[model samples]
Target: MLSKSHLKALSFIREFIVHEGYAPTLSEIALGIGIRSKGVVHRYVQALAQEGVIELHAGRKRGITLPEPNKERDMTLPLAGRIAAGRPIEAIEDQVRVDLAAFFIGPGRFALQVCGDSMEEAGILDGDMVVVAQQEHAADGDIVVALIDNEEATLKYLRRNPQGDISLIPANSAMVPMVYAAERVRIQGVVVGQLRTYGKR
Candidate 1:
């Protein structure tokens, strides 16, 4: 069994790779896990390599790599039970599996990590990953990734006025909406789902 430190190191490496699109160096790993000793970090890496949890490439500075996930395994979780968000309810067991792949994976679907709190009221916080469906057109009130002037991109609620102006509305009440000419805004994608990690990110 892997110790707590091993798990923490593994988790950090995974997150770093997902965010940066490459493996982190030993020093980066040490910094990420709050350890001061590169020797200790090297030992942890060697242990993980011995356990077949990661691969190490000799002569490479950033050689750590996670094994590929088994594609045949179903991406699902047990439904288990349901809980109320408001009123109290009786707990009941469920026998269903929630197929995450069905909901989040499809042609033209992609995910983007949120970077700001502009959509907090809509339950999309900073650091959350939003699954988006690629499309060029969106109806009014759809939360979408909008490209402005073919340059800057932002996530907001799409709104159209009779005057042919488009408004990019933020979920936060503290912020005002941005108005643009209809021709200046391009619809990139609509948000379909979202995911967030609970603990240390």
Candidate 2:
């Protein structure tokens, strides 16, 4: 079990890594938590390191290494969205950042913002940011983001019939089901968690 002070430090460190995409330095951690000295923060971080929660890579710039969320008490993870797979993953630029590493239980994760009413009945309306785990395959009835016809990308429920035909299921009855030969559809990510901003509708 971790002491209260250790837990507080861990929470602050986790927040920094989530929002900043990098671990905070001792000074930054100290200041963020209302402490005055980097030395104090270093001591707490050392204790966390000793507990095997985080690893410090001394002599390397930006040397903090955090274990996967599976190794920690926080089960959520940030579901990252489609990145230019050809380019590097960019920094998060949302107005308010969420630490979703605890929510993403998958081994891989990413996030995307919702943009349509097709899934509105599921309460995933426009402007909701959903965290999706990157996955190449899923079982029937999994909600997934898929690229269809190379021109349209949609969020839908994947249904695989016994005959092996695949259909994209929409929650609302008004929208017709889209059926395709299983070979043409590409799975992007599986929905793991949903986050709605306070004011964004």
Candidate 3:
């Protein structure tokens, strides 16, 4: 239900928040959409806020934040604190809402919970939820979720040999690489972001 202008504004806001950790200013929004009037930009922003695409603060200049729409639209995930501070923790009864679309890049992206330490050297720890973008193919050295022999799924660095054979290299050196013929393996997606929560499950 969003117009082209409104969608453009949302796209700009998405990119700005991803890179800057805050919303763009009115003038910045204007420049992004080629609007000559700040008033016009403000109106567009207000419209977006009304649509539940963004949350607006009344008094602050950089007050726009992506709305955490739980059952409405967009993905919501728990942000359970930091990794540095650690302990055996239990899940809290109350949860904070965070819109995962703000952090993810492409459409059709999904998350998977990492199960083992096979990719620990790559900074992917067990219990980490990896955001993966669906794809049929991948470039060299890209970490990908791959289906092996049409049965097993695994996360590893994908390397294709000149002969077209595939090597699934585990980041943890202790784990040996897995080799398979190109015909036997299917690429499901590429790892885009790794999410982890500490002090809570």
Best by lDDT: 1
lDDT by candidate, in order shown: 0.76, 0.70, 0.75
Q: Give the TM-score of candidate 1.
A: 0.52
Backbone collision count in every prediction? 0, 17, 0
Candidate 2 segments exceeding 4 Å error: 1-101, 105-107
- Order the candidate numbers by lDDT, best to worst: 1, 3, 2
RMSD of each: 17.4, 12.5, 10.2
What is the per-residue lDDT of model 3 for residues 1-201, given as tens digits with 9 covering 90 to 100? Answer: 356788899999999999999889999999988888999888889888866788899899899999774747645644322221011122222354445655463456666666677788889887787777879989999998787776567788899999889988887767678889999988878888887889866
Per-model TM values vs. the true structure: 0.52, 0.52, 0.59
Displacement of residue 40 (Cα, Å) in model 2 is 29
Q: Which 10-residue span in candidate 1 carries the lowest summed lDDT?
A: 82-91
Window of ten residues with lowest summed lDDT in model 3: 82-91
Let me know the TM-score candidate 3 reaches against the reference structure. 0.59
Pairs in steric clash, model 1? none
What is the lDDT for 142 in model 3?
Answer: 95
Best by TM-score: 3
